[model samples]
Target: MSEALASLLTALADDELILGHRHSEWTGFAPHIEEDVAFSSIAQDEIGHAAALYSLLAQRSGGDADGLALGRDAAAYRHAVLCERPNRDWAYTLARHWVYDTADAIRLEALHDTADEDLRALVTKMSREERYHLIHADAWIERVAAGPVEGRMKLEDGLKEAFEEALGLFEPIEHEEKAVHEGYLPLPSSELARRFRELAANKLDELGVQTEIYSRSDEAAEFVASSSGDLIASGDEHAESQPERARGLGGRSGHHSDEFQDLWDVMTSTYRNNPGATW
Candidate 1:
């Protein structure tokens, strides 16, 4: 209920929402049809997670869930920069998938024990879905890391590039201190960034892949800036001042890059023409 906790919730929800949108772009377009189905499920789960968290946030923000989602200006979104980065290829996307889900597991595990009953409950439920995402990413990481020369090369290349971007997954929630103080979220005292990287490295090592990780203090900040540029510039609100106090990237805070305007136009085209119409 505190401002701090509410901010953290907004950050968490926005990240999931934007990332879900990025993932949806690959639907029916992935390399294999079966993989398409699998990827679609992950994308849907992310959106579902975002919606659930948004429902929680809406309770505090005093707005309907849909409004929290579709009505917000881009600057209001608090998702990390990595979530907005373009999905370059299947390998890169999968690399991102593996790293993100692993980091999320670490985060959710800590949250599941929070004193806030509602938050704890949401984390508990999301934990189940996260398990599937981890499995999906892990399976593909191994798959691409094996068998042929081309596959291995793609996996290695993708992991190399994505590993740096994946560090963005640790982008700090602005109200972290308050969230912890209020018992709304409980991240472990142990170094989560370190643990997450170690886990990811181990997974890659098992698959005969070697990844180079940058210093978190530097990489996370960089990812946020670059990814936000891609998301906001690709749309219409590219000229807004950066959302300095909002925390995280452009769209989540309302200062979206121009690209989001374009995306918003398409995403809301149908709804705009017929406000109350149903499919």
Candidate 2:
């Protein structure tokens, strides 16, 4: 595979894998039994999608899919920081789910015309399942919006918190320009980001939710990922940095929040303990 294609695949797969793990965290703890089952099923689908993407990467890159998915170090993951965040509350979880699925749908739609036949076919397959996930997220979003004032407020707060970090979902990967130039990605990350913002705004407007979530200034270029997976200001030549400051930043470059280490440890424990073991 070309470097650009490999990077793109790795980013996509990592996002799915990490977010699926987060979704699975709600398996037993969801507010109700129906939600518990729903989230678990969604988690399974996401992880399955990750596995399929990794399998495609393995085929072209001569690597093991399991190894690619389970054996990578924390800093080696290319997921958006949003995916690795802890699900703090039902409202926040639903908010993040809606934003992510919306962006993911845009991404998959754009990939339908990719130059690579294999990738286009895989995208088509994934989109079939992803449609239901989008519906689930959209329904919950509308439900929360139409419910009690407190629930609506909390959901809005979640959107405010999640929207900025969600932008990292469209952060460019290494050699992304080449990928676009080659028709592997018909649209660039900037274009995708624009579409995400527009789509999100329209949806929120239609639902009578706050649409000011996109008003934040662009700070994406102000931070760089440190060696320890922390995000530090690019201009902070002499300033001390901490892992706690890593939110909403540096994910495309493999930088992650402190929470990622905990997630990584649990997610990879079995693979680390018994290398090459398979069920």
Whose lDDT is greatest here?
2
Please provide TM-scores, in order, for all candidate models, with all chains considered together. Answer: 0.79, 0.89
Candidate 2 lDDT tens digits, 1-279: 788899889999999999999999899999989889988999999999999999999999987889999898988999999999999999889988998999999999999999888889999999998899999999999998999999999999999888878778877776777999988888988788789877888898998986666554144424444565445545544536334442476788887888999999988999999976886
Per-residue CA lDDT of candidate 1, range 20-105, in tens? Answer: 88899999999999989889988999999999988998887687667777766556666655576678898778877777788889
| lDDT, each prediction | 0.68, 0.85
Which 10 successive residues of model 2 have the least lDDT summed? 216-225
> RMSD in Å for candidate 1, one decimal?
6.4
Among these predicted structures, which one has the highest TM-score?
2
Error of 2 at 121 (Å): 0.7
